[model samples]
Target: MTLTKQHVRDVVDIYIRAWTKQDPDLILSIFTEDATYHERVLGEPIATHGGIRDYWQSKVVESQANIECELLSLYVDGETAIVEWEARFDDLVRGIRKRMREVALLEFDGALIRSLREYWASETIG
Candidate 1:
């Protein structure tokens, strides 16, 4: 099935909500039950909702990182999409603010994301 603009918009909204809230339930709502998530420079891929929940909890919610994202571009073909985005966050762990530009390769199951591989480079901000 072709991925519609509405679908991309919905996914992007969910993505923003997930980061802004850092709520596991809200994050899980954007993914299929058996979805997979990977951050290229990070550790191993998380392949279950429970794993994703834990990952997000430790890395985001528990750390109390405030995140903001800007959607740069989105390209869709069939059930897959590539999204370019910029994110800025306070890294409580490192005691610094950071900015990252990332591209996410996403595979969708209907409106939900089934697989997301994110590639990013982060810079420390003044």
Candidate 2:
């Protein structure tokens, strides 16, 4: 199976939708069974679909954050994709709003994401 530009865009779309909807299933649906997710702030990567689901559940659904992700740029080369995204969301715990720009390096298995590493920095908003 080959990955296309549209497929990469669709994956990004699904990712944004998952965050906006705070749906664990939607988030999990986009990852391969053995997918690994790494975040710059985290000490270790989240391994496997189950771990990804649990992480999203806690950071998104459980936190009751409203997230909106915007795709800034995207480039694809075969099974690898590089994406820049901006996210604006409410931080329920901090009782404030925040904005972040992140770059993700994603590897695909067919149309699903096989591995993802993201780097991001957040800004506080009143």
**What are the lDDT figures for the candidates, one per model?**
0.87, 0.90
State the lDDT at 40 in candidate 1.
60
What tens digits encode model 2's per-residue C-alpha lDDT throughout 36-113? 999753678899989999999898997758788899999999899999999999988888899999999999998899
TM-score for each of the candidates: 0.92, 0.94
Question: Stretches of candidate 1 above 4 Å error?
Answer: 41-43
Worst 10 residues of 2 by lDDT: 36-45
Error of model 1, residue 116, in angstroms:
0.3
Q: Candidate 1, which ten residues in sequence have the lowest lDDT sum?
A: 39-48
Model 1, residue 37: distance off in Å is 0.5
User: Candidate 2 lDDT (Cα, whole model)?
Assistant: 0.90
Clashing pairs in 1: none
Give per-residue CA lDDT, model 1, range 15-125, as digits (tens): 878887787889898899999999763777898899889989898897748788888999988899999999899988989999989999999998788999999899999
Which candidate wins on lDDT? 2
